[model samples]
Target: MVMSANERLFYHVLIRILFVAVIAGSLISLLAEQFWVAELFTHFRLYYLLLQALLVLIFLHTGRHTLMALTILFAMPNAWVAGPYLIPVYGGQRATAKAATSIDIVALNVNYRNDGFARVAGYLRERDPDIIVIAEYTPAWRDELEFLRKSHPYQFGEVRPDPWGLAVFSRLPFMESELIDLADTDTVHARFVFAAGMMSLEVFAVHLLPPKSAVWARNRNLQLENLVDQLGASTHQRIVIGDLNLTPFSPYFSRFIERTGLQDARRVDGFHVTWPVSVFPVWIPIDHALADPEVNITSVHAGPDVGSDHFPLEIRVSKGVNKQPGQVRAVFE
Candidate 1:
C-alpha cells in the first residue's frame, strides 16, 4: 500500500518531533546529579526507550530510514540503562559451604493512611519471610504485627507517625541495632547487625524522603551521601535495603552504589517496579536492596498489593549468613 503525500508528511513530522523529545529527555537524565528536575527525568528510563522504539517503528513503516537510524542510535543509551534489570539471573552460582545459610527478607512500605491491617497482616503470615522490615510504620502497625513475634523472635525498630518510621522483625538473632539520625541532615535510618559464624553481617534499612521539592531533594541527596559514613567502618558484609525513593537511573544512585560498592538486587531480579502501581502506565523502581560484593541475592519476589501505593519486596540473601545444623529456634507469641 502507498501512503498519500499528506499522510507521509504527517508521519514524518510526528516521528521527527518524537525523536527530538527522546533525545532531550535522554540528555536531561545526564544532568541528574546537578539538578533535581533532571534527577526526576532519570527515573523513567524504560519510558524513554519505549517512546524511541515507537518512533523507530513508525519511521521504518514510513520508509524514513535516516530518522529510524538516528532514533535507534539514541535509544541505545536508554536500552543500556534498562536492559540489565529486564533480564534477571535465573540461577546464579552459589557458595556450597555447609555453613552457608540464606534468609528471606520482606520489605514493605505499609502506607500510613492505609487501614487494611488484616490484608497486610495476612500477607505477612502467608509469605513468612525470615526477616520483615516495615517502612512507613505507625503505632497501629505495632499491635497488628504481634502475631509475627512468635516466629521472628528478635525484633527491633521504632514506631513513628511519619512516613520515615520503620520496624524490623527477624527470626535470626541480632547482635546490635542502631537508629542512625544525622544531626545536620535530620535523616533517621535503621541498622541491625547479625552474626554469621565469625563474619558479622549488617543490614541497613531505610525509607529516604521523597524528592518532592528542592528542599526535599537537597536533603535526600545529603542523606544519601551521609548514609555512606553513617553506615560506618565497613567491618561487616553490608545489605542495604528499602524504599530509597530514588531509581537506579539517577546519577546519585550510581554514585552511591559505586562509592559504597554495594550490588543492586535488580541485577539479580528482573525489572521490578514497586511504586505508583496505583497509577496506570507510570511506574519506576524506587524500592531496592543493595548488598556487599560478597553477598548473594538468591531471589526476589513481589508481594501482593496490600493497600500501599508501593508493593512489598521479598528478597532472599544468602552465602554470608550462617545457621545451625538442623537446630531450629523457639517461637514466642
Candidate 2:
C-alpha cells in the first residue's frame, strides 16, 4: 500500500494537532490546580496519568519521538503528585510491639438511598470498631443502626434526610462533644477522656459538600479552611475522619494537611480507593483519616462495600506519648 503526498500531509497535520492538544491540556492541568476553575480537574489526577500513558503508547507506535518526549516531560508533574500515593513509602517505622492502649475507628458514607442496612450492620459487628462515623445518615439509617447502641452507648450528631447528615457512635464515653456549623455545613467534634490508663483523644466526623460546580467547590474549600482553623486551635491529639469528598491529590487536600499539620493515614497505608465501588478502575479515594502528629497510626485499611457508593475506612491508632493533663474542655452544644 502506498499513500499519495496529500494523504501523507493530512496524516502529519493530524498528528501535529493531537500532539499540541495533549501538550496544552497537560500543561494546563498541572498549573491550573491553584485556580478555583481549574481545581476541579485535580480530582482526576489519576485519570490524567492514565491518559498520558495511553498517549505515550500512541506516540511510540506512530514514531513521534518529539511528541513522545514532550508528553513524557509534561506527565512528570502529575506523576510527581501521584507518586507518594501509588508507592508505599509513607508507612512509618514498624512497631516492634503493639502499644498498650489503642483506639479503632470506622468511617463510612452510607448512601442515603442504599437499603443494604443488614450488610452494613453485619460489617460493623465483624469489625467491632470503638468509634463509628457515618455520613449521609438519614432517618432510615438511624433506625437500621439502632442495634449499635448495645455496643456504642455514646452517640453524637443528628440524622437528617440531606446527604450532609453526619453521626458518630463511640463505645467510650465522651468528655465533651460539640457540633459546629462551618460554611453552612454541620461538623461534629468530640473529646474522649478515657479511664485512668487510656489516653484522651479528640475526634471529628465531617462531611464536606461535593464540588459539583464552581460555587460548590468554593464552598467546600471554605468549609475545609474553617475546619483546618478549628483543628489548628485544638490542643488534644486528634483523629479526623469522614467522606471528605476530595482525593489526596487535590491541591486543597494538600493545603488542608499542610495548614493543619495532620498526617494522612492513607500515606502510611496503601492507597485504598473507596468511591463508586460499582466501578472497577474508575474509583477514587474520597474518604480519608487524618491524624494529628501525636497519634500513631498503627494500621489503616478499607472495608468491604456495604451497598454504598463509598467503602468504609478502618483505622487503628495509639497514643504517641504518655498521657498528659487534659486541655480546657470545649463546650458541647
Candidate 3:
C-alpha cells in the first residue's frame, strides 16, 4: 500500500527531529565531559519522554527500518534520564553561609585554549580566595600567575611543559605536593595543606581525563574512587576540587560523593554551567567544588569568563571546630 504524501512528509520530519535531538544531546555529553544534557533537559525530561513516545506513530507508519532507527535515536536522550537525572536534582546541593568561622575556596578549569591569563589572574586576585585550584594550565600561564604570589604566597604544581597542566595556589602553606598520574598522559593532580590552629587540611586538585570511551570512563571513576578512599582514610579535613570531567549525574560522580562523603556546593539550589563561555547567559555548571563534611561551605558562585571555554567557580568554606587535630576521625564513614 502506498502512503499519502502528507503522512510521508510528517514521518520524515519526525525522524529528522529525533535524529537531531539525539546528536545534540550526545554532543553535549561529549564536549562538556559532564552530565550537561541531563541538566539541560532536567525540567523537560518528562516532555521529551512523552515526545519520544509520540514518535511511535511516525515509527509505525514509516516501516520497520525507520522504526528501529527512530527508536535508537530517541533512546539516547532518555538514557541520560537513567541514573544521572537523579544527581543534579538530588546530589549537587548549593550550600548557604550560616556562620562566621567559615573559610573560602574556589575551583576553576580555565580552558587551556584561552589566552587571557591576565584576566583570570586578576579575577582570582580580586576574589581573594583562601585556596584556588586550576586545571588545564600551560607554561605560558605561569608568567601571568606571578601576581598571585603577592597574596597566595604559597603555591605548588609544575608548569606542564606540555599542553595539559594542573596547579594549585593558596594563602595557606603546604606540608607536601605530589603529582597523581592515573595512567593518563597528563600531569593533572596536586595535593597541599591548609592550616588553621592545631589542624591542617589537605586538599587534592584533580582534573580527570576526558571520558570519551567506556574504558576511559570506568578508569576515571576508579582513579577518583582511589583518591576518595585515600582522603577518607586521612585524619585531616579534606577537600577535592577542580574539573572532575564528570557531573553529579554520572555513576562515577555519585560513587565519589558516596565514597568520600563530600557534598557538592551547588546541589542545594541549582546547577551551574562553566563551559563555552562565548555562549554567555546560556551556560551549565561543569566545574565543581566538593568538600568533606568537616569543611563548612559558605557559598559558591560562577565568576565572569576569562576568554576560556570554562568559567571560574568561586566558593567560600570554613573549617569546623570538629576539624581540629585531636578530632582525627575517618573523613567518610
Candidate 4:
C-alpha cells in the first residue's frame, strides 16, 4: 500500500528525530566513560553497541542525508569501543608450553538469599577446582560449604552475613594468608606454594561494592585503585579473581587493568556473561579472573548456574618461569 503525502511526511520527520537522538545518545554514552557518575551506562557497552547497530539498519531504509550522517556518528564510537572484544584478532594468547605448576580457580557470587546450597555444592564437587572463591558468602552459606573442607582444607576470609562476605578455599597449602579491608569491603590475599616448593602463586579473592549509587561507585573505584596498588607492588605470579562488580568495559575496569598490568582471562577465552543470569540481555561479566603478565591463562569459561544471580567462572592458568619471592602487602587503610 502506498502512503499519502501527509503520512509520508509524518514518518519522515519521526525517523529524522530518532536518527538524531540515536547519534546524540551514542555520543553521550561514549563520552560518559570519562566520568564516574555515568558508570551505569558504561556497564552496558555491549548493549549500546548492539543498539547502535540496530539503529543503523533502521536508518539505512530512511535514505535521508541527515540520518546517514547520524548513523555514521553512532556507528563509529560503538565500533571503536566494541571492536576489540568482538573481533578475533585481539584475542588473548595461550601458554606455549604447559607448565607442571598450574592452578584451576573457580569464582562465584552466590546471591545471599538464594538457597541453592545443594546445587552449588554439587557443582563444586564435580568441578573439583584447586581454588574456590565465593562472594556474598553468608554464615549459612559457610555451613553449607563445610562439606568441601575435606578437599579444600585451607580457608580464608570471613563468614559474615553481609553481602560483601568473601571466602577462599584451596587444596594447596598457603604460605601466607591475610584478610585486608577495603573502603567498605574485605578482600582475601593469600600465597600458595606448590608441594615441590620451587614456585608460588599469589591469589587475591576480591569483592568490590556494587555501583548502585554515586557514593558506591566512587567507593568501588577507590577499592579498585587500592587493589591495583597492592597488586602492582607484588613480586609474584598473581591471580585476582572474584565478583569485582564491574564489567570489563567500564572506565574503572580499564584503569584497573592499566594500573595492575593484569590480563583479563576473558581476552583469550571469549565473553562469558556472569551476572543476573535470570535476565539474558542485561547480563554482564562482573565476575572475572585476572592474571599477571607472567601467568598464562590456559582456559576460562562460565560454569552452569547453580541457583545464583551470578554464574560461576572457572579459569586455569600456567605459572611462568619468572617468579617473585615477596608477597603483596595490603595498602588499604
On residues 239-325, what C-alpha lDDT tens digit does candidate 2 reach at each position? 678888888888789878777777787766667888888756878889898876556676777889788988898887774452332
After superposition, candidate 2 runs with Cα above 4 Å error = 1-25, 31-37, 50-63, 89-100, 186-198, 320-333
Among all candidates shown, the one with the greatest TM-score: 1
Candidate 4 Cα deviation (angstroms), residue 176: 1.7
Candidate with more favorable, higher TM-score: 2 or 4? 4
**Residue 310 in candidate 3, Cα distance off native in Å:** 0.7
Give the candidates in order of lDDT, highest first.
Answer: 1, 2, 4, 3
What is the lDDT of every predicted structure here?
0.78, 0.75, 0.64, 0.73
TM-scores for all predictions: 0.86, 0.81, 0.68, 0.82
Report the C-alpha lDDT of model 4 over 119-205, residue by residue, as the tens digit.
999999998888888888899998999987889998877776768777888888887788877654454333333432354677777
Q: For each candidate in turn, give its C-alpha RMSD to the true structure in angstroms.
A: 6.9, 5.7, 7.6, 4.9
Model 3 TM-score on a 0 to 1 scale: 0.68
Question: RMSD in angstroms, candidate 3?
Answer: 7.6
Which regions of candidate 3 fall more than 4 Å away from where they truly are? Answer: 1-100, 183-186, 196-199, 280-283, 321-333
- Ranked by TM-score from best down, the candidates are 1, 4, 2, 3
Clashing pairs in 4: none
User: CA lDDT of 190 in candidate 4?
Assistant: 34
